[model samples]
Target chain A: MTETILKVDNVSKAFGALRACDRVSLDLRLGEIHALIGPNGAGKSTLIKQIAGNLRPDSGRIEFLGRDVAALDTVERARMGLGRSFQISAVIAEFTVLQNVVLAVQGARGTSFHFLRGALSDRAVTEAARLQIERAHLGGREAVRASDLAHGERRRLELAMALALRPKAFLLDEPMAGMGADGVAEMTGLLDGLRHEAPILLVEHDMDAVFALADRISVLDYGQIIASGTVDEIRAHPEVRRAYLGEEDAA
Target chain B: MGRETLLNAAIALGLVAVPVWAHLAGEPFIITLTTKAVILALAGVGLNIALGHGGLISFGHAAYFGLGGYAAGILAHHAQTFTPLMSAPFIIEGTKFMPVIWLVAVIVAGLAALVIGALSLRTSGVYFIMITLAFGQMLFFFAISWPAYGGEDGLVIYVRNEFPGLNTLDPIQFFALCYVILGLALWFSHRFGRSPFGLALNAARQNAERVQTVGIRPFRLRLTAFVISGMITGLAGALFADLNRFVSPSMLSWQTSGEIMIFIILGGVGRLYGPVAGAALFIALEHFLGGVSDYWLVFVGALLLLVVLFARGGIIGTLAGREVAHD
Candidate 1:
């Protein structure tokens, strides 16, 4: 594996009596798609939230770029090249798609504090934003209000924004949750191309997309990893079958 | 031309034209009435920055307003009596200069906003509103207890403060001073709304989580807007105290805070001239309706109810038509 870009060491989180993430450890290598699959309430979300710096883990540490990031908040982590896509598709609905992406571009460049010069007149920010939007196949929809876009288009817009940061690593939480069949296929193709750009930590439910795009798969059940290996290895793992894919699939 | 542009021009022209016509006809009282509208509109513009653009509903802005009024009253008091305000270090003598008073007013208000915003912005929704209102009331009660400047009875200025190259006591000249200030404020608000900082603040208001994901701190953006908003309102408060030649606790009341909010809500929230339009309508109703009956506010209340129910975008948005979607 290439140099590990993100390392989660024995991370754990609990809410009251229920243990959400129990000593979870995972590492994402450069230019690799690491898929995390689990049943509902498998503590997958808890782990992702901790890594994204949104929730504080009770134990262990999260290290990004070989430095401990346990003290950082979400915005600090984001500024340090940790790009993320929200599961519910968070976006400023009042802003135009171009403005939304431009806001991200400005953030990445650390020039969003400019007050006097009109942002609409800035060619550099506008061009960079346009390029990201175009890459997401949203070329003509730049001026469209974000809320007016279709559900799948909003997902694409979110991806475009996430990519605008030129992030070293991506943490996408169910990016395909609300997409239709064609949109899913299109997104899978898009993500398949994006692996060379950066490593992606994908937490998804679509097995076909996971099997097709993931370089390696890790099965999570009840806040613990049952199995972790290459796609075919995970496909043939007997314990994973009984725990996740079901015994009938193994037969 | 687009409807918004045409209506904007008309509003600007109407505000100026009526005052000019009344001035030439030798009816100076009409000019005083229009000047009242202009000054209140200036206060509304200040509130718009926090409420409309920054999406901070500060129910305690009257604190700055009252403070600004007191700053003017206190300074003029010392200047008129030929007494130095302080002697411990160097003597701090008060001045009758309007510019100096305005500077002090803006700084005092800006500082107050910084403190209140720092605390109140930590909460949101109804909590934010209540915290701000509580702060205003705290100051209000303090002003009532402090009898040095007349306390609840209020302080009065015998002569209006001086402005360079003008007789400020003259109604027309005073109106001109206010008119020029309002125009500059309007222009500033216009340029500010489209700048990067303003856009980021707007995004923060709409979805703070999204802003954080993009690596921007919503709190910083909000605090900056709040300070600027307070300074503007404070300037208006100084002028307002000058307008009545009096500084009173009524200026700091929660009812005054509600009135400022009414100006914004009755105008377009995000529109540049919303406060101007709202202020004009309010002044007109107060003057005309109050002249006609003892209970004119009932009619005004009914009118406000109608606007809130049906015209959600306020007078500016209603007249401008739906925003034309660009290709």
Candidate 2:
């Protein structure tokens, strides 16, 4: 077994009467894409928020590199290499693509205290930003303001920012969301290659992409994991069919 | 140079030229009016760092301004009276030196901002604005009730503070000193908006959650900007008190905070020289319109409404075009 880079052990979250996540236990090992799939209200967002440090679990421990990170905030988690991409693209609308990527690079390298020098002028940050921009296929549009970018391009920009973190693991929420067929295909290839750099905890709606990329699949239903297994095992799982995946996939 | 840069240069030249031309025409009062504009512009510039770049609408900035004025006034008062600032412990003495007064004002204001920002930054938007206003009002009433500083009657300085070789008593000399300080402030503001810290702060303003996900805490960034902003405004307050030869509770009033915010809105919220343009226009309107009618501020109010309704970017944004990415 490869080393477990991220461990989510018995995490539970409740909002009033509704439990968002209930005793969720999952882990991402090095160099694997572990896909979390569910219906609209399957508590995927809540789980991702808990993992990303945006929401707190009522009980359970989240360990990154064998150390518990339940006390950390979102900023602290990001600093500790827990890269996250939002479902709705969250790039700085006013900043150019390069600027957005440079922010992530600056954050990762701990250069935010630099008051005198321009972030762009810093060769180290800019170079890293450029590399990530290229990796995310945003090479020619470096100077484009994030707001002006096409929907697919904005998603790519998020990926670029996430990559710039040099993260130990990625908690990507719907990276293929709002993309056309071509965009989905391109992102699928990108996520396919991304597993080598860092393990990915992908929360995606696209079944095609998830099935193609995920070494292991976790099917979430009403804040509980109905099934957790390899792609073939999850496909064949009877409980997963009734709760999620639907009768269509099973047939 | 860019269009805004050219416009800024023109405004700079116009500010200097008007005072000089007024001095040549023997219109000392006009020069004084221009000096007031410069000092107010400096205050606006200070607020812009927090309000504009950091998206922190600090409605209580007048607290720093008033504290700065009181620092200069109290120091000069004690200096002339030959009394130590404190009788016990360290036995610190007061001096009527401009640099020392300015230093003290900046430090005091910065410290105040640190405390205020620590509490206030926890809430955002309207809550943030109200809390800041509350803090400013608290200071205002404190100053009004404090008998040692003459309460609401205010403190008067017999002479302006000294600044090395130049005679600060001369209008032009004093104007020159203010102009130099304003220039330094504008240069700093320009550079600050492009720096790494500025980038992070700006990002935090636009999308704080995005900023956090990028591993930067918006609270620390905003607090730092607030302190720096307060320090700058405080410096302006000292200059303003020196200019008037009086320090009063009115300097700490909510109306003063509104006026500083007006300077930013009138010029351009985040524009480098937005406050400069806004301050100059505001003073000009007050001077020219006050002579015409007692309700001169009505016209200013109307203009502010028009700016808000039509030109959302304010004066510089309307004139120079929409905000462009500096990078």
Candidate 3:
């Protein structure tokens, strides 16, 4: 078995009287793609937020690479090689594609205070950003403003930015949420290629994409995990069949 | 390398030539007016860091400006009596050199910014504006009631403070000093706008969530920019004190804060030369309109409202037809 890179031990979160995440626990290992799937308001986003250090869990422990990361802030977690992509595309609109990616590289390189020299003109920085852009299939769109990119292209740019950090683990929230057929395919292919590079915690609703890309699927209902298994095991589970898959087949 | 650079250089050269002509034509008042314009523009450039690029509307910048002026005023006052600042274990006496005054102004204002930013950044949107305004008022009241250095009436230097190898009393020479400092501050603002930190600051303004997800803390970035902004404005305040040979609590007033913001908006927000253009236009309008009538501020207010409603992008922004390309 691959070594576990992330461990979430019985984490729970609540909003006033409403339980957003209830006793959720999951482990992610190297070289495996873990998918967390649920209906709307299933507390998937809340759970992911806890892991990304944007929200603190009400009760539970989160350990990353054997360190207790429950108290670290978002930027601190990111600096420790935990990369996240938002559910909504969050690219800087006014900045050019190259500048956006270069910022990501700058974050990783620890040279944000270099004021005298132009950031774009730095050979090493540009080379690194160029490689990441090419990896995300944004090689031809380097000079284009992020605002000018198509919807699908913006999604890809988000992925490109996350990858630029060279993270040890990736927490991707709905990488294909608003994407069309072609966009989904491109994203799936990108995810397929990324499985060998780092562990991925994917929270998505597209059953077909999840089953195709996820090595292990976890079904979340009402903020609690109803079942967790391989794709065949999840497909055979009676509760999952009645609650989630049945609605999909009916549609 | 770009048309923007050429235009900037031309404008700078034109400004430098103005005082030279004034010197030759024996118009000392013109030199004084130009000096005032340059000093105000320099201060505007400082505010532009937070206002234009960082998207932080700081209404308390006048506090730093006043602090700088007070630094100059207090130093010159003490220097005349040869009094020690502490008179204890460490004897720190005052000096009248521009460099010493500028250094003190920058340091004090930068520290003030750190405190103000740490507190003001806790709120966003309209709340941020109000908090900054409240801080500015606090400083203004302190200066007015303190009883030190002439209090509400203001402190005046008997002579313009001297600089090494320069006649500080000459109108044209003093104007040249103000012009050169303004030029340096403008260059600094331009360079800061293109740096990595500046890019991140702009990113934070555009999409703060995105900037955070990429591992940059928005609050820290904004605070840093705010401090730098205060330091630059504080330097300008020192220059202004020298220009008028006085320091007053009026430098800390909310009206001064509003005027600084107006300069940026009237020229074009976020443009490198916007503050310069805005300052020049504002001073020119004040001069011409004040000469024509005593109630010139009413016209100025009307014009500002019109610009805000119809122009949207200020004078240079209207002419340029595009946003300044940052990062």
Candidate 4:
């Protein structure tokens, strides 16, 4: 088996009386898209938040790149190469597409303390940002303000920033949340190619995209992983059918 | 070149030319008035770094400004009296040299800013504003109770502090000195706003959480901007004291902080030359309206209301269009 790049060991969290995540254990290896799918309240977002260091689990451990990261903050975790995208697109609204990506490049490469030189004129950072922007298929809209971009383009811009992190693992939270059918198809193709760059832990609601793109699917229901397996096995799991996918959808 | 750049050049030239014309026409008071505007504009520039770019609204900047003025006042007072500033820890004598006073003022103000920013940056929005205002008030009262420096009566320099190779006592010369310093400050603010750090600071302002997700801490950026802002305002405060040959607790008051904020708002909050325009308009309003009525500030308040409601981006923003101000 490929060496595990990210490991979540029995992580559980609760909000007052509600258990958002209950002893959830999962792993992402060297090169694979691990999709975490569930109904709206099944605690997928809560799990993603814990792994991204935005929330602390009530009980359990998260290990990234064979190192314990229990005490690190969101910024530190991102620096350590765990890139993430928000469920709702969260690009800097006033910044141009190029500027937003340039900031991400600057963040990942280390210190942003260079105070005299113009950020856009820095050839190295700007070039890297351009590459990512092109890869995300937002080539011609470099100077367009993020607020002015179309809904799908903003999602692409978010992905561009995540790619600029040059991360070891990606913790993507619903990459296709508000995208249209065409946008989904294009994103699915884009994500299909992204697995070669880094292992992705995708939390998505689009079942067709999930089924098509997931190398391994984990069925989450009521804050617990009901089943985990390859697409065929997950499709065959009886309990997963009852708890998450109905009989018609599972078939 | 951009229209804003042209406008900035015209404003700069006009500032220098008016003072020169007044000197030739024997109106020394005009030069003094222009000097005051320039110094106040420099303070506004400092606050802009925090409020405009970093999205930090610091309501206590007068603390640094007053501290800077006191640094100059206290130093000049001791120097004129031929007394040692301290004797126990180390023998430190005061100096009247402009460069030395400026250095002390910058360092003192920068240090205070560091402390205030470190604490105040912990909260944001109204709480941030309130915390900063509280700190400023603390300094104001501290200055009032410190009788060694004349307490509420304030301290006065017997002579204007000396600058190298120039008679600073001359109104035109002093105005020129202030103009040059203001020019340097505007240049620095311009460069600082476009730098890589500035980009991150701007991004942090727009969305701090997004900045964090990209592995950048917004607090550090904001605190740095605040300290730098405080340092510049402190420098301006020192110069302001030198201009009047006096330093008072009123320099540390909440009213001073509000005036500084008004300067930024009047010009265009984030625009590079916003402070310069704001200060010019303010001084002009005060000079013209004060003659008409004792309640001149009410008119200024009305103008501010109009700008906030209709102008959105302030004077420059209204003239140059909104697409390209800070950038």
Put down candidate 4 lDDT per residue, B2-120, tens digits, no spaces. Answer: 87888889889989998999999999999999999999999999999998898888888899889999999999999999999998898999889999999999999999999999998
Angstrom error of the Cα, residue B128, model 1: value is 1.2
| Tens digits of lDDT, candidate 2, A1-251 | 78999999999999999988999999999999999999999999999999998888999999998989988999999998998999999999999999999999988887887777877898888999999999999999998999999999999999999999999999999999989999999999999999999999999988889999999999999999989999999988989877777756658
CAPRI verdict on model 1? Answer: medium
Which parts of model 4 are misplaced by more than 4 Å? A247-251, B325-327
In candidate 4 the C-alpha lDDT for residue A206 amounts to 89
Q: Report the candidate with higher TM-score, 1 versus 2.
A: 2
Candidate 2: stretches off by over 4 Å: none
DockQ of each: 0.65, 0.78, 0.61, 0.66
Model 3: residues with Cα > 4 Å off, grouped in runs: B1-3, B323-327
Per-residue lDDT, model 1, residue B52, is 93
| Of 2 and 4, the candidate ranking higher by lDDT | 2
Ranking of predictions according to DockQ: 2, 4, 1, 3
Instruction: Estimate, for each residue in B212-279, the C-alpha lDDT of model 2 and write its tens digit.
Output: 98899889999999999999999999999999999999999999999999999999999999999999
Candidate 2 at residue A176, lDDT? 94
What is the lDDT, from 0 to 100, of the residue A144 in candidate 3?
A: 89
Better of 2 and 3 by DockQ: 2
Candidate order by lDDT, highest to lowest? Answer: 2, 4, 1, 3
Q: List model 4 lDDT by residue over A194-227, tens digit each.
A: 9989999999988899899999999888899989
